[model samples]
Target: MLKRKISDYLESYFTPNRREALLITGARQVGKSYAIREFGKSHYSSFIEINLLEDSIARTSISKASNSKDLLLRITAIASQPLIKGKTLIFFDEVQVVPEIVTAIKFLVEEGSYQYVLSGSLLGIGLKRISSMPVGYLTVKEMYPLNLEEFYRACGISDNIFSVLEEAFKAEREIDSIIHRKLMELFRLYLIVGGMPAVVQTYLDTNDIKKVVNKQREILSMYVEDISQYDINNKLYIKDIFNLIPAELNNPNKRFILKNLNENTKFSRLENSFIWIREAGVAIGVYNIEEPKLPLELAKLRNLFKLFSNDVGLLACQYADGIQLRILNNDIDINYGSIYENAVAEELYSHGLKLYYFNSKKQGELDFVIKLDDKILPIEVKSGKNYLRHNALKNVIENKDYEIEKAYVLYNENIKRVGNIVYLPIYLMMFIKNREIENLIWKIDLSSLPQ
Candidate 1:
């Protein structure tokens, strides 16, 4: 069985002490249900599963329940397994089909009969459509395609190796040359097979390229079907944009041009189309930042951005057949820049960073910049031998106006520190994660104010 980091996440999140409803959401085929099922079976005395998409009777019975108690009654009537109070996990899968269930979740949580969990393919869009959102009663965690670290574990790389890599990154030391070459090979394979559970499984099971490509295509088709089924009003624009992502990323600058979809169209006219694909969790949009500074959102130029397929495997599948083979052979003839950028994007996005890149006519462009530990770290993604030649990155760092102390260049190289730049292997992005949590308690000077 393929391992996932989210499995551990589910355990840590739903301890016996914390009573809360949970929602596991991501793009279709990212393995949300499988993770939930495994967690439920292992942790609970009884696991009750309700899949609305496959069970018409269950969908019909529970879709329109009048209240929390009535909903519970309807749920219990069609449950596939026993529901033991305080020891059961009632998983509502494919909940996008019956989103009103979210409206009634607050009352259900208050009732506190069984631990509740929900999952769906397009919860980002479906949850927004709910008339009443259970604001404080529910917790949400988004699942993503497996990152390099999780993929490493699945491939049987030991935990000790991970610790060594972490230590190497922290100390800015080069990995052993032999180990680095082996890892580089593995990382390229990861680009081709990707972290989608099904695709990864196909690779591990048969080690066949044709099977992996076929699986990725099936998923891409399913995404198109999801668009047609869910957003009938704007499926045309959405599909056109979705279909164009591969070609668009291959462009020189890799910034998606709205005109590419339709010569006469403007971003204002086609804004919802972009939003639909993003909300569906089928694509990642990395916005262009006007200035690299704190609060990257404020500097964000929404109209200017790069759109990437949510999974690199799907992106590769969208391309002509030989790209994967080329990637594996380490052929530098094709422009691997877009592939590298997309990999970096998926990694950064999965780790909860808002994707931003700086582009200035005077200063050139930094591939990505993110706020980490309360400061912006400029990033450059290089896939060629000329990894050290980054005029844009150099300009950004030297500009005293920005006061940016450090930056990172993710390349096919070992860890090194030269001046303010930290060069790392691209896979180390699995280690660059959430901003450090701050002390939320802000006690005021009450004595000075009142005395």
Candidate 2:
């Protein structure tokens, strides 16, 4: 079985401190069900799974229940395994088909008889229509596909390599040359293989890129099926936008032009299309910011943005066949700027960073700008050897008004630093952790006020 970081998150945060039920959300095939099952069976004495897709009768049972006790009775009747009080963890799969489960969970949670963990094949707008979604009663945590580190572990990379990599990233030192070459090869393979669990597993089992691409295509088909199921805005709007991601990303500027979706149409008509794709976790949008400054959302030009596929493997599969070989071969002649950017976007996003880019007439475009360590840190993704030739990054750093302290340039090369710019290996993006700033304890004394 593939080791996941979410297991640690469950053990450390959700298991010990779960006052509210947790709903693990992400795109389908991202391994939400597997993670939940693994954790529940290991942690609790009794693990009861209720899959709505398999048992349609549970939907009626969950909806008709009036109170917490009744809801528990209905769920227990449908559960596959024994539901022992206090010792059991009930796992709800494909909950989207049974929206009533969202309402029933609050009552079940209040009753406090058995622990509950819920997940579904789809998220975002799938749950949006829930009129009373037990917002405070249910906490939500998203699970992404196997990220770079998880992929490394799945590929059986050593801890010593990870330790050395972590140390070098922190110290701003070049990785050992031999290890660097091998890791770069692994990183390129990651671009083709991506973090999707099923796809990764296929590659791991067979050691074949052909089988991996086939699995990726199946997931893409599932996404298409999911889009058709929801019919958000218009089915065409969502599907077309999704299909256009690879081509649009290949554009010079990479900003998704609404006009391309419909030549005579306006963004007003197709707004929900983009919203659905984002909410569905089918895509990540890096919006254009008017300036590289604090409070990026306020300065965001929502209409102007770059859209990337949710997973890089799926993105590669969307392109022509045999590109995977080129990537694995470390092909440099091909224009893979979009692929590199997508990997960075997916990595930063997995780290819980909201993405934005800086573009102006005078200063060139920065691939990504994020609020990290309490400042706007611009990121530039380079696929070619000329990683240092970033004019836009220079302009943003040189500009006095932006007050940008430093930036990161990710490439398939060794780590180095020049002045305020930090150049890191693209694979090192695995360590871009999600820090907790919510409980920052800071208080100024007002007792010294002038009397």
**Top model by TM-score, which number?**
1
| Candidate 2 pairs with clashing backbones | none
Q: Which ten residues in a row have the lowest lDDT in candidate 2?
A: 10-19
| Candidate 1 TM-score, true structure as reference | 0.96
Q: Residue by residue across 1-451, what tens digits does model 1's lDDT show?
A: 8788888888888877566889888999999999999989999999999999999999999977888888899888898777888898889999999998877778988898888899998788888889988988889889999888878788888988899888998888999888888888999998888889999999989999889999999998999999999999999999999999999999989999877889998789898889889978999998999899888899998899999889988888889978889999999788888888888899889888888888899999888999987888999999988988999999989888788999999999889999999999988887887656888988777676655
lDDT of each: 0.89, 0.87
In candidate 1, the residue pairs with backbone N, CA or C atoms under 3 Å apart (3 or more residues apart, or in different chains) clash, namely: none
- Model 1 deviation from the true structure expressed as Cα RMSD, one decimal place: 1.8
The C-alpha stretches of model 1 lying farther than 4 A from their native spots are: 435-451
TM-score of each: 0.96, 0.95
